[model samples]
Target chain A: MLDYPALAALAEIIRRGSFEAAAAALNVTPSAVSQRIKGLEERMGQVLIHRGPPARGTATGLRLMQHLDQVRLLEDTLDAALRPASGPATLRLAVNADSLATWFPPAMAALPVLYDLVLDDQDHARDGLRQGQVSAAISSDPEPVPGCDVLPLGAMRYLALATPDFLARHFPGGVTEPALRAAPAVIFNHKDGLQSRWVQKATGKRLHLPGHLIPASEPFARAVELGLGWGMIPEAMAAPRLRPLLPDLPLDVPLYWHVQRAMVPALTPLTAAIRKRAAADLRP
Target chain B: MLDYPALAALAEIIRRGSFEAAAAALNVTPSAVSQRIKGLEERMGQVLIHRGPPARGTATGLRLMQHLDQVRLLEDTLDAALRPASGPATLRLAVNADSLATWFPPAMAALPVLYDLVLDDQDHARDGLRQGQVSAAISSDPEPVPGCDVLPLGAMRYLALATPDFLARHFPGGVTEPALRAAPAVIFNHKDGLQSRWVQKATGKRLHLPGHLIPASEPFARAVELGLGWGMIPEAMAAPRLRPLLPDLPLDVPLYWHVQRAMVPALTPLTAAIRKRAAADLRP
Candidate 1:
């Protein structure tokens, strides 16, 4: 059998992408990470990592590492929940930009429980849970982790919006993928592909546009409202000022709540709280 | 604004927790869920659900409903490499037993991905993504979701195991909270927690008894193998197992998976092929 701790260290190195980075993340020396991976490989009787400047995982090593990742996550959640109270249970959570910008703040403010909030784009939030960084998470995935519980939060509606001026300048007449692609588009980040997906759905073609890449949540929304570019905005946020240039074209994405299975017992209160809150906040 | 779809109807009802599960889930059912909740309230809501579920937002409805679970996940993984496909690409995924055993499969597998695959018991399989989940997935979360794109795959892990021989001999050896509050223990779920949390770490109360729940992968490894007085397992399937051990102890519990958020684009032909194979063979 592999030395559990050493394997864990190796996995971390692979996860962090390099020995130095993994060491930095773990607050250990890179040499330690290197030794751990080397030891793990020798114990397993197989090479687990593909060494290079920026190291990668060998096939078998990657497989073992991935499995170790799951086991560790489950173990951590279970430990946190089952272990006696050391302090208030800190629920590390993730949320999307639009939700945080428009609705999450109120929900967070309303949360009666004490929690350590780690906010991020909804897409990135689940990563925290997988890495054993958080106990529970608000994710777009309704799917539960292996030993976890899942609650459906609901769908967040997205509307394609733009300031009257931006629309006039971009669309001129009617809105279509070609037109939108040609016009400058606003994105929370280059990774905000909702617009591209939307365009593809509308025109049956992929979008490869070069435009402004604003990297903040509130600012991204503001840029669009300020007539910087035409983009997809959450309906809840769009409800106030932004007009739906294309009403027929809308994007609706479902959301979910996932909690570690081991934490289920401890989660009763939290789940209840979240469910109650979701009941009041989400749109129909 | 988000696109509201009809498929979300049933899902929304369930999510909103009643006929009014949540309008956000239904997209067209706020009043519908309301009427449903109201009607159900007249019929069952009053009995099944409590009023003031949480807080209704500013004419926006459920404040919690505004939380987009999926978006949060996607955002976390947004930095990942784009899917190889042009249009709405299918996302192959990997997960574990606890997640599959719970309610998550439905929500995630139910989605209309271009293609999707879920690797079960991902505590050991996440490296498959080094092999790929098309784009991402739910795995035993540890370190980053791997490769830049990372997020929390919130779920829990539990330790529980038993064996026919052991049970026959022990017969409720401290089963309840007050009972075997001290006894032999087992930590079955593979690097999981049955012994550590419930016995030792939990308020420092030791099992003092004997035995260990050696973690196992599948059919042979469930709680029954170790003779631990019905250990903690994911709630989804634990109930059935408890049937045989009735009057002894209930073993159902929950676990979690912290997922990574790395997107290895399906750029290379080999990578693309593996992704395709994974989607076909791995999804639950």
Candidate 2:
């Protein structure tokens, strides 16, 4: 087993990429960081840090740092659970930008307990947890984080949303499969798989759209609302701003809830409160 | 959030169905478990478990217990990462029965290292990681356990594999989408999505198979190899045991690597060694 404090310090050092920077971040002396790492290596009977100008990690050191990252994530989750809910419990959560701009606020409002909320893109939020930043996350993946619990929150319904004008201008013939294959589309990010999934569904073939790729959640939604192109939008979020191009056709994407595992102790009350709120807020 | 130790204890209690039994499993006193729960509740300002003739989790408690279950899974993953290797720092990963019995071994061998080998199914062998079992795992999911790191290991190529006899018996005039839709198929497990993926590939339709749902990995492979039924097998795994029924047919599934994130520290040495051996062993 590695020393907890030393492991933590090493994580900071590796993340910061320099002893001096790590010392500055932790408000400790550079010498202290060096000494601690040396001590840790001596204890482990293996050299952790590779001594060089840039200062990269040895194979063993990187593994330990990864472990430390998980420990920190578990710690943050535990802190969230342990924090007294005298006021509102803080929910530092990650959600897709589309979900946040659309249905997330209502879900947050529907929570019986007051909560201090922080939201980010689903792709980046888990990184916050790994860095000891957040407590819970809503991800597109069904797999849970290592020390975290995962639950199927529910699927978010998406529709190929478009404005009446855009539909008239670009897809006048009722948006058939062939037209869809040739039409422009809105995507949240470069890695967005929705368009492909749609194409696969519509044409029975996987085709990549060479259309515009906008990364911002709200801007992307607004662009679609302004008739930039036909794009997939969460049904709940799209309900108020846009209408489904085809009222009968909707796409459903699964959403998962991942919470820290070690945080289970403190999570008991929080999960109870969150689950109650989620059951009411999330779509079945 | 919930109490870490307490929530873990609660999960054990629920799994064991008795405080005494849980205590024995944890090697602690029943009174200690009781005390831990009491402390946990006081910290959370909520009643979690309902103590009575048979101990049961309150609705809140059940939610908390579920969280703990996920946490335990992470811990198991962590344990797998930290396990000591006997000779080399290389890992012995177990894969799913279908993957191992099919295409994954070549991929594993194709890696750049010679790993101490053990192959199992996605369902069974993943437990090895949770129980301090293995160092790395190739799972069907992209999500990493809480304490683990995740990477896109790449996708597996699947082909409809069967003995010539099986194909002859089922589709005498050579297989087509319609014949496949009507024939009795072999499934590795009830939850196995290979058959469905294949169905969708062949017909652009998602249809559930009405054939045998065999759960065992080796037997499942043997069943297909022995002309039992037509099922999807990894392209590499199928190379020797069985020939592709349709060489030009398209059927593939993504494969992912879910490694203990903490194990990233050890990755430098581990990966280096694995890569060396994988160059000689794993198939492209």
Candidate 3:
């Protein structure tokens, strides 16, 4: 059997990113934390952490931490079932930035847990589940990872939008492929495919886009409003101040809720909450 | 010289995170893009990219990209001086979220460049410069990276804030060490030291803080406002709806603008704009 205390220490080090920070979080001396890891490493016959100034977990370390998280979650749920007044659980979830900015918060608010949110582009959020980095995820991919359940959470509609001034200046000839290729775009990040997908959907051709890259959801929307670029914005966050580049062609990305099957019992309330919020905010 | 077109291809591949995506951005066929990289790699005699489904840069690859960026910026500035109608340059920068959410956007707007922003904790932002991932960075550390000039940009004051209900429920006996240990906090992320620093300043003791981790500046503050947990909030974002736990013991983190000395001539307008906005928003 593994030393759970040492396992806990390993998880803390990865989460906090340093031996000293993890020591502070665990209320232990750095020396003690170091010793525990050393002993555990010796017992396991493998190195688990890369001891950088900002420490990082090796693959084995991450796997162990994932295991600990699952076990603790199960225990917490069991304790709650018995006592009815146990402390709130800690759930690490991967959610897209737009969802967090728009309709997701109410769902989060309904859960009685401390959240550790990992924000990724919706198209790639499922990678968090595949990599065992998150307990659950909100993703555009409907396909479930092995040992995970997928629940359709409806679709987030995106409109290709720009400010009035931006449209007047850049698309004086109307929203043509040439104008789109020439105009700047506000891209969320490298992983974000909404802009390219929207362009393809609207124009039926793939075009090279020059743009500003702003990663945050709010700022990406704000950049379009500031006349930096045109972008595909979630309909929920599409303010009246912005006008659509192609009003007839809105992209609706279907999102799914993926959770480890074992976690379903503990996470039913959150699932219900997510469904409730998505129903109101997402298009059919 | 050293195959500038091939280097541009490499940068695009890294930025877009896939060979196909890079090809789309460069308006080249994927096979042509592949040949350019192949020839470049043979010329350099070292691997430049980790060809994942989502591609990544090697250490040398990133260094080359940084070199290309600086060259492009200098050339763009020269072109503007001569003809004044050249295309906008792309400037990659690292900035702390709080500053971006509050005082930084105006500075960005004042500059005539397409921005690629990297968000990190204020304490860690300078690493982007040290690692050559960015030409400039907004950091809390006054010390400049080697070959960089640091300009003090005043300070962001923080207040230990919580909802009235949270205070009543969690700290019935006021903000003592025991109560602090028992109550949860809202932390920005692993690199965020504001809460620990504030707690140390207030109590002169290190306490293990149980908390929720919300990475975004707006969502982090919103977590505290939603009563998920108390957190150290930037004074600019501390809403009237929340009350300070210890009003007198505010933490002021001084910020600095770190720019590569060689790029300083091109960034003069941005520096002026940053100073102007910081003067209005940050505490002296």
TM per candidate: 0.37, 0.39, 0.94
Chain B TM-scores per candidate, in order, are 0.38, 0.56, 0.94
Tens-place lDDT per residue, model 1, B1-284, is: 43223222322332223444346323454666455444433542233233443222221122112222233334433455753222222233454534433434334323322222333444444454443322444555554434435434333534344555655555555344343433344333224434445544443563322223222222213323323234555433443433333343333232223322332333123234433433443322
Quote the lDDT for B66 in model 2: 41
Residue range B76-170, candidate 2, lDDT tens digits:
34565673331111244545544444333333323322233334456544555555345567676655565656655445667788877667776
- What candidate 1 gets wrong by more than 4 Å, as runs, is A1-87, A106-114, A121-124, B1-284
DockQ of each: 0.01, 0.01, 0.61
Candidate 2 off by > 4 Å: A11-21, A41-137, A143-148, A199-207, A239-241, B1-284
Which digits, one per residue and each the tens of the lDDT, describe model 1 over residues A99-132? 5445444343232232334445554555555555
TM-score (C-alpha) between model 1 and the true structure: 0.37
Best by DockQ: 3
Sorted by DockQ (best first), the order is: 3, 1, 2
DockQ of 3: 0.61
Error of 3 at B137 (Å): 0.6
Stretches of candidate 3 exceeding 4 Å from the true structure? A79-88, A122-124, B79-87, B122-124
Interface RMSD of each: 19.5, 29.4, 1.7
